[model samples]
Each structure stands twice: as C-alpha cells, then as structure tokens.
Target: MQPKLPIQCPSCESSLSVTQLSCSNCSTSVSGNYTLPLLLQITEEEQNFILQFFLTSGSLKEMATQMGNSYPTVRNKLDDIINKINQLKTK
Candidate 1:
C-alpha cells in the first residue's frame, strides 16, 4: 500500500505545508510552499466519511445502515464534519 501523507509535524504537532511535488511519469519536480486543500487537511477518517456520504447519494439513512450506526449518530458525524469544513474555510 502507498504511504499516507503526513500533514502534521511529528514533533510539534503543527500543520505542515507542501514543499515539493513531482510528476511521476516525467520525473519533473516543482517546489514551493503550499497549504493543503481543506478536504485534504482533514483526518483520513473524515475524508472517507465524506466520500461514503457522496457514494450513498447523500442519504443519511443509507449511511447509517452501511456504517451499522444509528441515524442520529451518523447525522451527528456529518454535522461535525460540516462544522470543521466551515471553520477551515474561515482560516
């Protein structure tokens, strides 16, 4: 499996910025400081939840059933993610 991107500093636990990117096929490299997208800045679990939400056609009931969680639980999870996204947008 591919390694996950490290978004936080290992020692300080602060957010990290992208410093370089490379083209896999051409071996071309680009270097610059850049912030990760809001979606990518979230935890992987949150990202997967968002993906699952879309895959289920944005149906909370379907998501709850698929996750073996109660409807309110799934709804709360979605609400939390939405709040996080909004907070990120303001920054």
Candidate 2:
C-alpha cells in the first residue's frame, strides 16, 4: 500500500511544507517551498469525514444513521472539523 502524505513534522509536530512534486509518467520533477492546501493540512480522518459528508448529500441524519452515532454526536464531529479547517485557513 502507498503511504499517506504527512502534513506535520514528526519531531516538533509543526505543519509541514511540500517541497517536491514529480510527474510519474515523464520523470519530471519540481521542487520548491509550498504550503499544503487547507483541507490537506487537516488529518486524514477529517478529510474522510468531509468526503463522507458530501457522499451523504450533506445530511447529518443520514450520516448519523450510517455511522451508528446520534445526530448530535455526528453534528459535533462535523463542527469540530469545520473549526479546525477555519483555523488552518487563518495560518
């Protein structure tokens, strides 16, 4: 399996910057200091949550049912992810 893209420094727990990109087909590479997108800056779990939210047609009720969680619980999780994304946007 392929590894997940790391968004934080393992040592200091700081946000990490993307410094390289490559074209798999052409073997072309580019390198520079680049910040990860706000969504990508969040944890993978959060990303998946957002994706699932979209797949559920943005319905908390459906998400709650599918996740076997209470509606309030699912809503709170989404709120927390929104807050995290907002914070990342400000940085």
Which candidate has the top score in TM-score? 2
RMSD of 2: 0.9
Error of 2 at 49 (Å): 0.8
Task: For candidate 1, list the clashing residue pairs, or say none.
Answer: none
lDDT of 1 by residue, 4-82 (tens): 9988999999989999999999999999999998998899999999999999999999999999999999999999999
Q: Write the per-residue lDDT of candidate 2 for residues 1-91, one digit (tens) a residue.
A: 9999998899999989999999999999999999998888888888898999999999999999999999999999999998988887887
Give the best candidate by lDDT.
1
Candidate 1: residue 78 lDDT (0-100): 96
Alpha-carbon shift of residue 38 in model 1 (angstroms): 1.1
Alpha-carbon RMSD, each predicted model: 1.0, 0.9
How well does candidate 1 score on lDDT at residue 80?
99
